[model samples]
Structure formats: C-alpha cells, structure tokens
Target: MNELATKHAALASRFQALAEAVQDWDAPTPVAEWKARDIVGHLTTWLPEMAAGYGIDLPKVTGDDPVQVWREHSANVQALLEDDAVTNRVVQTSAGDQTIAQVLDNFYLADIFMHQWDLAKASGQSVGWNPEVATSIVEGMTPMRDMLAESGQFGTPVVLDESHSPEERLAALIGRDPAWTAG
Candidate 1:
C-alpha cells in the first residue's frame, strides 16, 4: 500500500476501535458543542461531498446509529483510498484543484486523526496513536495555524507550559485543550 493508503488504514483502525469502545453516542466531547455522535455525523456528512469531487460515489448514511454510519462511510472511503483511479484523480476545492491523495493528506486524514482524539476523549477510551503521525501533522499544520484559526475550523490555540509533551502541543495547536475532559 502507498503512504496515503497506509495513513487511511491507520485512521480506519482507530475509528473502528472507538466504535467498539463507545457506549454512549451523546457523550460530550472536548470540542465543546459537539457530542460523540456529532463527531461521527460530521465525518459522515463530509465524506460523500469530498469523494464526489473525485467522481467517486459513496453511499449516504441514513441510520441514527453513529457507529454504523461511520463504519459504512469510512469503509467506502478506505476502499477508494486503495484505488489508484480514485486517489490520483484531481478534484476542485475552495483551495483550487488537487488530487484525491493531496486532499486526503492535507484535509481528510488530518481531520480523521484529530477526530480520533476527540472520539477517544469523549468516550473516555484510550488510544495509543503513533507518535510519528502526530509529530508530522503538527509540523505540517503549524505554519497554517493562523489561517486555520481564521477559517473557523479550529478554536484559538491554548497556551501550553514548557512541560507539555509534543502530542499535547499538537492537540493545543489544533484548538483542543490537553486538559479537556468530557463533562
């Protein structure tokens, strides 16, 4: 498998694990306004629209079971990631035209990565994510911090003390407070 495919698979695994672990769909998340179900809903709502730009058809999620909805949509996305025709296809976005691979790397994968943390935090589940992945995402997105904040995609970054770890810093960079706990 290629790099993008590998990354997608990693995300899929995390999502699947979260699905199995979660017992409450309405559990609050660190995202403030979004609940556990809303996290899945957000992804289910976006996957099809993004895939459509690459001429890939994804099944619409219809059920109220957020886990099932995520499972179905994520499976479709994972299949598309494995297809060269889908991954290599160029698609137009607000940022201009980019290959599906590029979009996955720059947007979808990062979204999944961050949301995995959200899901875990909301569900009170622990996930041992690869440090390398977190570090890479942090390094890649740090330069765009101002733009992402301005775009309303992320909250204002939280100030971290020097004692914080890289992963904690990454979480803060993406507008998630490392100290956040689901109420």
Candidate 2:
C-alpha cells in the first residue's frame, strides 16, 4: 500500500468503526440537520461522483446501512490508491491537472479525516486525531474561510479557548461545535 492508501486506511478505519458502533443512524450530528447516516452518505456519494469525471469507476453506495456504505466506499478508495495505473491518471483542478492520487491526498482523504469526528460524535464514540494533520488543515483552510463559507461547505466559525486541542479547533473551524454531544 502507498502513503495515501495507508492514510486512508487509518482514517477510514475510524469512520467505519464508528459506523458499526452507531446506536442510532438517526442520531443528530454537530452539523445541524445531519444524521449519523448522512456522514456516511456524504462521503460515499461525493467521491464516486467526483472521480467519475476522471474516468475512475468506483463503487457508488447503494444502501442506507452506514457501515456497509462506508465499507464499500473505503475499500474501493483503497484499491484506487494501490492501483498505479488509475492513481496516475490526470485530472484538472485549480492547481492544474494532477494525478488521481494527488487529488485524493488533497481532497478526499482529508475530507474523510475531518468527518471522522462528526460520525463518532453522532454515534457516541470517540475518534483519535493527529494534531499535525489538524493543524495543517486549519492553516490551509483559514485563508479560504470566506470561500468555504460561501460554498456552504463550512458554517460560521465556532469560537474555542486557546487551550482547545488542534483537533477541537479543527472541528470548530469546519463548523462543528467541538463540545456538541449526541442527544
């Protein structure tokens, strides 16, 4: 497995685990109006649709079972990471045409990493976070805060104390209430 594959496995394992542990698919997440299942749905839906433009035929999620939805998606993404022929294919982006692997590293994997907390919180579980990655995410995104908000991908920033961990700060930056818990 490559670096992207390894990272995806590590991050996606947490996501899949949370999906399995979910006591309520309908449990609300910090992202208002989203249920635990929506986290899985979002991850599963977007990437396949996005990758289709690059000619990589990944599996589209078919069922509402969050665990199964995540499992299928994760497996296919991992396969893509390991497939040199597919990963090397170029796709156009703001950064110019880059390989599928690069795009995955920059976007899909990061998204999965960030959403781990959302799914975990909704499922009443805890997820491990890498402060380094969290810091990088915050730093990289802070400059694009306005564009991100305008795109409606993130919400108004949630304030946190200086003592908050990088992961908590990341959650807040991405529009999740760091202190939010499942009801």
Candidate 3:
C-alpha cells in the first residue's frame, strides 16, 4: 500500500486496537462522564454521519445505553464501509465540507489517529501510534486548520515537549496531552 492507503490501514488497525482495549474497560474521563464505552459510542456515531455526508442513510442513535447505541451504530458503519458509494465519495457536513479524499485524509484517518490516544488514556491502554501515520495525520490536518477547532471537543489538548517522541509530540500538538492520566 502507498502512504495514504498505508496510513488509512494503520489508522484502521489502531481504531480496532482501541476498540478491543476499551471494549471491556469501564471508567470516566474528560471526553464524557460515561466511560470508554461512550467514547466508542461517539466514534461509532460519527461513522455513519460521515456516510450521510456521502449520501448514505446510516443507523441513528436512539438508545439509553451508549454502548448499545455504539454497537448498533458500529454495525451501520461496518455496512457503510462495505458500500463503495459511502466509502468512495465525499460529502459536506456540519463539521466542515470535505471531499472523500480530504475526509479520508483529515477526518477518517487523522481523527481516528488522535482518537486512539483519547481512547488509550480513557481505557488505560497504550495509545502509541506509528510515527509515519502520526506525521501523515499532522501534515494533512494542517491545511484543514479549522476542523479541529470545530469538532475537537472530545480531544484533550496535546502538550508538546522537546523530548517527546514524534507521535507523542504530534498527539500533543493536536490537543491530547501525552502525560494525561485518567482519574
């Protein structure tokens, strides 16, 4: 796979790892008061939202338990992923208008990169990402500057330090504090 596809695949791996790590994890943190389940729920919610931007009707959240909502939504997201139209086309949304390429570049790829860190901290698992993917996300997101400010409510501020690893620094620069520990 080329760099972009590789990055996407890597991010997909990280998201899967995050999902696995946090699946049984139960705790609360800054993103939401619920737990890691809620964080996954939120990501699951956005999956179809992105599909909607691509003109696909995805499952909607209408449940009390965030985990159940996420489970249903994840099923929809999985189905959408199987559909070429939803995955291959880009569409605009309340977050920001982006082409499919840009969405994959910025949101689908980068958002998940950062969210891995978020999920890691919230679940007490290592959220470390490969440097190449981190660098790619940072570079891609640079042009879409405002997207972070708009939909970044869930991300914690990434704290920078000269001694930090490239991935850690990249994470911090985007809003996640590498040193953060969920209480």
C-alpha RMSD for every candidate:
1.9, 1.6, 4.4
By TM-score, highest first, what's the ranking?
2, 1, 3
Cα RMSD of predicted structure 2: 1.6
lDDT of 3 by residue, 49-158 (tens): 76665666877776655445545655554555555554566566555765465565555655666777777777778877777766765665555446555765535444
Best by TM-score: 2
- Give lDDT tens digits, candidate 2, residues 1-183: 777788889888877777788898888998887988888888999999988877879889779577887888789888888898888888889889899889999888888888889888887787777788788788888777777778788778664555889888889888887889987
Q: Give the higher-lDDT candidate: 2 or 3.
A: 2
Clash count for each candidate, listed in order shown: 0, 0, 7
The clash number for model 2 is 0
Q: What is candidate 1's lDDT per residue for 1-183, written digit by digit as tens?
A: 788888788888778788779998888998889988898888888878867756778776868888778788888877878888878988887889888889888888878878888888888887566777777777777788888789898888654544777678778988998878776
Which pairs clash (backbone N, Cα, C closer than 3 Å) in model 2? none
- Which residue pairs collide in model 1, if any? none
Which one wins on lDDT? Answer: 2
Residue range with the least summed lDDT across 10 consecutive positions in model 1: 157-166
Candidate 2 achieves a global lDDT of 0.83
| 10 residues in a row with least lDDT, candidate 3 | 153-162
Model 3 clash number: 7
Q: Residue 24 in model 2: shift from native, Å?
A: 0.6
TM-score for each of the candidates = 0.89, 0.92, 0.66
lDDT of each: 0.80, 0.83, 0.61
